[model samples]
Target: MRASVSTVQDLGMPAIYLHLLAELLNTIGVDERALLLRVGLDPARLKSTDLRVSQAQASEFVTRAIIESGEPGLGIMLARELKLPLHGALGTAVMSSRSLDEALELMTRYLTLRAPHLEVSRREEGDNVLFNVSCSMDLGPLQGFIMDAMLFGCVSMGTQLTGSPVPGAAILRRGPEPGYFHRFRQHIQVPVRYESREDALLIPRANLKLPVRFSDAQLSASSRAKCEEALKQLTEDAGFACRVRRVIETSHPFPPKLARVAATLFVSERTLKRRLQEENASFQNLVDHVRLERAGELLKNTGMNLSQIADVLGYADAANFTRAFKRWTGTSPSHYRSQALQPIKPQASSMRATA
Candidate 1:
């Protein structure tokens, strides 16, 4: 079916959890590239570490894939791929650990990088460590599902880290589903509040200082710096980043950048690039991000032909655009376009699950 660019403008950014969901889709025989286009992305460009995309794009793509493929909780279905001591094939890594605190610390550290939205915080009070969860605001829906996964992941990690039963530690937020609680609650027999101030777990603080089986001080420091930079950039200029991003909200290739964009901004290319760089951004990056951001909107709502969509992004040819998509998502243009034939659904709780 043909897609209409105008229609996709209404669809917003995707939720963070959806990216994990897309990874999960691979195990279930879903063509991830087709899924990319379904959410308005060209599967080729996902490789640029600096390139940015919106949560809406991820959500729209997965949602469309689910509807078209008739799959539910596509993210959960792919849990086997994760490396954290949570749900994947390697989950056994945390299953036998030296101490409970070390297990919690290791799982928290690993998962934070794997799941960007799941913010994990730790504080010490003598031997017990107080852990707080601050979810990424980028999460739209699917927050509940991710949250559920975290609960179990936490329990599993704690058990694995300590090599002992994870006690029913007190939790701050509303508890899990009755059946879920019943199945996983042996170690979690503590009290839970309906609406607590934060989503956190109270543990022995001494546990945090305990070294993990896998230690990488250098890598941890490097990751911390990168995350800090991303956060700083996103916090200070995300408005401008998002504003400039609207230029290419779909998977289409970027236009040769109108000499007129500078003219309209009342500056020279040299001047614009200089100013943007001063803010630590480049014009091309903004254009690419807008394309990724828009990709989600387009795939979820539009009916423009893939070729037409390519043209809208100002690509000279569909093939060039397809190559770019493959870089981003490991798929082609037409296939990504083909994935956008369904409606997106709402997520559970404005409170995200991953974080």
Candidate 2:
């Protein structure tokens, strides 16, 4: 099944899914026990108020489950029943925004209200918008879940604004797994990038000025103060781009031109190019390298069809993706995956497993 969320409530931050998973698993009777055993996790860990499964532990656990089930879509399936709260003054502010842009700003400001470790911000990227996130905490078992929920949030907000999910979303994520890319793009119409600098959701610049029904000047005045007042007391200082990283860090196929991205940073693309050149990189090269890195991961793991893989990497079609993959590595996806499956290098960051 393509990525689909039926629940009306917003899927809260990543940990929300963990909590939901724990509860669901418990309700299912021994589901938690079974899920935990695959990762060598103790069942009691799920009982904690906020479970802290280390990255290593989570990687091992999810990897084992994927292999045993031979079902690459498990994480997304687990994600469907999650509910994100639309409560709070921030939620009210979001509901009250006059445009998707305003709603985005509301989300950017209020995201930290619930998840202190994650932050989101946006800036004009010329004819585009650049939403960004920066984070200090390791989400561990909740990483994918949290990231997926963020994507859902953005889509839902945009859909709410236009009364339908827009087909223009382009996602970027740095994770190498094909599963995430496929999982992401299967539902969202735009391209999904894997193994990119960060996760980002992009909409056209045209959507910036859209009029929202709830943007009444008086009501906005009333709600604006409430949001700002709450923001003032926020004890955490983690600012901007944590939520953005959730998408682009996995796949970065839908990259606009570096100059375009540079424009979003309020810098000339030429100047941006010059600065990146100073750093021994160019925007296109960075985007390509990220895509290649993600392609490598997708080829190595997951059983997704090659056409599906191509779609996720932002190719016009399978042939284009194949040619690019061969160009990048001088071999086919099949050959690459065959090579990648050998000995599966163990690493702290690489989420790996065998089926």
Candidate 3:
């Protein structure tokens, strides 16, 4: 499904999902406290499943864990541990779905409750149905992990509901096979093709018609209604900020004017400002956030010079871009780029202080 532009904002993932990750980290002997701290997340705050963490925090934490644990398949490992209870009403609705197809539909519709950054849609190609997954924002290094978790989670959950491995199922991943490719055979029980053009799950159309063992019509209806209500509330509470941020991030020629953004959102400039204030954000702040993020990505990944980066970010000159970069990161763009590119060196004492 094509997610509405409103869903593109960086609202965050639910704490329950993070809780699962923390549990996985703890199980694997990783320092959960240290990991949370690295991402500026409070361990105490995650105790409540009702809370949410910013996408930046979530991505950083995942990246740190991946680096520290050396587990390239961390996402799949986490998905293996996930249970339906963690997903709230959406899980309930999925469990009560009459068939696998209905469950998939419910999952696609309510995925925002868990992974607001992703959009899932169904398409038919010949004899197979493809559940395509796309992201609304740039996930950067977290893309593979996130995609793995989502696709594996769906398959895992489908198995639970059907009491059988999903028949004629396969996975298509956009990136290369990870070092832990063996784990896919151990956990997925389905053919996985990496380095594909898209990230999707391929299921025979016949499997979509298979009945869910736990299907209950009345319960499914009630749970679905609850999901709808919860989704509506989530959208109202967090979507405006995300919408504004999405607009800023995707606008051509870099940051669009506040009035233009307001118009795109179909609200008056005054109302837009007021709504953003209510969400503890402002237009310029959002613009700066997008610019800084784009700037950092360009600086680290592209050979673009300062002036070119500035031009891409809508700045009149490299001087203005340097000033903004320093303001955002406490270092000039050139300095930041140099630091990022520098190779790590051992301390003299560790290197035997020889000479």
Writing each residue's lDDT as its tens digit, candidate 1 over 1-355 gives 3222222221222222344555566766777767775455545445333344554455456457656566544433433233353232123333333445544554565443345456688876665666777664534345544554565456445544444434545555554343334433443434445465566777655444454455445554554455455446544534433534532433433443535345423357777666666666677766654554444456555787667666766666667766655665555555655775233222223112120
In model 2, how many backbone clashes occur?
36
lDDT of 2 by residue, 23-91 (tens): 554554435556655444444333333223333334445555555555455555554443323335665
lDDT of 3 by residue, 1-355 (tens): 5334333565667766776788788888999887776555556556555666656556667889888888888889888877886788989899999999999999999999889888998899999999999988766678888998998888889888899889899989887787787856766778889989899999999989999999999999999999999889777766577767654554433567787667656679999888888877777777776677778778888999999989988999999988877765666788878889443222223212111
Candidate 1 Cα misplacement greater than 4 A, ranges? 1-20, 65-80, 84-130, 134-141, 149-198, 218-223, 242-355
Q: Is candidate 1 or 2 superior in lDDT?
A: 2
Candidate 1 vs candidate 2: which has greater TM-score?
1
Task: Tell me model 2's lDDT, rounded to 2 decimals.
Answer: 0.53
Find the 10 residues in a row with the least total lDDT in model 1: 346-355
Best-performing candidate as measured by TM-score: 3
TM for candidate 2 is 0.45
Please list the C-alpha lDDT of all candidates, in the order they appear: 0.49, 0.53, 0.78
RMSD after Cα superposition, model 1: 14.2
Task: List residue ranges in candidate 2 displaced over 4 A.
Answer: 1-87, 124-126, 180-184, 213-219, 232-355
